[model samples]
Target: MTYTARSIVWIVIYLLFILLPLFALLAGSLPPARDFWTEFSAALGYSGLAIMGLQFGLTARFRYVTEPWGEDVIYHFHRRISLFAVA
Candidate 1:
């Protein structure tokens, strides 16, 4: 499969957004002083919500984000993410 420069850029942007929270957590103070499971679960929830929101935005049909992968690919990805959201 071929990817345009814009598409490659979009991929990096998406990945960075997904990692934003982890980077935030790591770049800040140590959290071991806090409840591990509680913080971990909260982080997971926040990450999942962010991913879900991105999934919706991915369907906005913007050529810059969807062109390299195509509309069908984006829609299928959205469908898969929707299923994942229920879990």
Candidate 2:
């Protein structure tokens, strides 16, 4: 695939990776629904954790993964996303 196509595919994969936990939570049995803020907070926490976990892959420098974006772009994303995850 071309670089743009590959990048788009990777973007989709990244989104799926980050949302996997949220999908699992919805799929599994759970307690009664809580207030808006409580559920929102929980979702945010899960997203943050997923982003933090993805940091490792970002830094691993896998050529197939980095070829589309390049090392600099990947590291830049890693740094920015790390800050976002922390917040």
Candidate 3:
């Protein structure tokens, strides 16, 4: 499938959250320090904000479809990621 810009952004998110963090904990040997909770929380917050940004873009760019099947796309992605994570 040809990935559009929206797909690219979420692919980046997957890299940042699912891939980078995984490596950070394993290969990187990065310990969660005393202030790790704050850092981790901020990272999570950024991830959420990224999703919000995508949502805003999706709404602005696809208002017609957003009115009809927008949420289905979101759920579809969510389900795909869920299965991906499970694998």
Candidate 4:
């Protein structure tokens, strides 16, 4: 699949805003206190996993692109993320 520059930028922004924090939680690397980090990480990880699953379901339902430029870019990112979630 070919990714446009807009799609790449949106995906990067999505990762920064959504995925990065979740990843830190999953890794128990979010700072301040190590003891609490693990528990917080566990909780956030579960929530993040649930959100990811929901996104996957929604994206998988979209078999074709029908939106305009920005929305289409978002769908493309969603499709890519859905694939990553499956893996």
Candidate 5:
């Protein structure tokens, strides 16, 4: 595949991997929270946790994933994104 096509494919896969847990939550039985804040907080917590976990893989120097963006760019993002999780 050409460079553009390969990049697109990796982007899609990355998106899918990061969002897969959220998509599963939609299918599974949700928590019994009637108030919007409670549900919203739960969703936010889940999303943050998912992305935080995936950062490890992104920084692990995987050739296939890092190839699309370059290793330095991938590690740079991992550092920045991890800070949000810390806060």
Candidate 6:
């Protein structure tokens, strides 16, 4: 695929990785329903963990993965997302 296509594919994969855990959690048996903020907070916590975990892959410098976006852009995204995940 072209660079743009590869980049889009990677973006989709990243989103799926982050969301898969939330989906799995919802799919399984759960406790009684809670307030909206409580559920929202839980979802945010899961997403943050996923983002933080993916940082390792980002910094691994896989040529095919980084080629589409360039190492600089990838690192920039990594830094920004790290901050976001922390927040």
Per-candidate TM equals: 0.73, 0.95, 0.36, 0.34, 0.80, 0.94
Ranking by TM-score: 2, 6, 5, 1, 3, 4
Candidate 3's residue-wise lDDT over 34-77, tens digit each? Answer: 59788676556554554544544444545543443466776676
- Residue-by-residue lDDT tens digits, candidate 5, 1-87: 878999899778867876777788889986675898877777778878877888888888889888877988888888888988667
State the lDDT at 73 in candidate 4.
57
Best by TM-score: 2
Clashing pairs in 1: none
Model 5: colliding residue pairs: none
- Residue 62's lDDT in candidate 4: 45
RMSD of each: 2.9, 0.9, 8.4, 7.5, 1.8, 0.9
Q: In candidate 6, where is summed lDDT lowest over 10 consecutive residues?
A: 24-33
Candidate 1's displacement at residue 46, Å, is: 0.8
Model 3: weakest 10-residue lDDT segment is: 60-69
Report model 6's TM-score to 2 decimal places: 0.94
User: What are the Cα lDDT values of the candidates?
Assistant: 0.80, 0.93, 0.54, 0.57, 0.81, 0.92
When sorted by lDDT, best at the front, the candidate numbers are 2, 6, 5, 1, 4, 3
Error (Å) of candidate 2 at residue 81 is 0.6
Q: Which segments of candidate 6 are over 4 A away from where they belong?
A: none
Candidate 5 displacement at residue 21 in angstroms: 1.8
Residue lDDT tens for model 4, 1-87:
455764566456545655555665567655565587786766566556655855754455444332224456557766786666555
lDDT of 1 by residue, 1-87 (tens): 446666778778987887797778788877666687898887888778778879868989997677788899889988987788657
lDDT of 3 at 29: 54
What ranges in model 2 sit over 4 Å off?
none
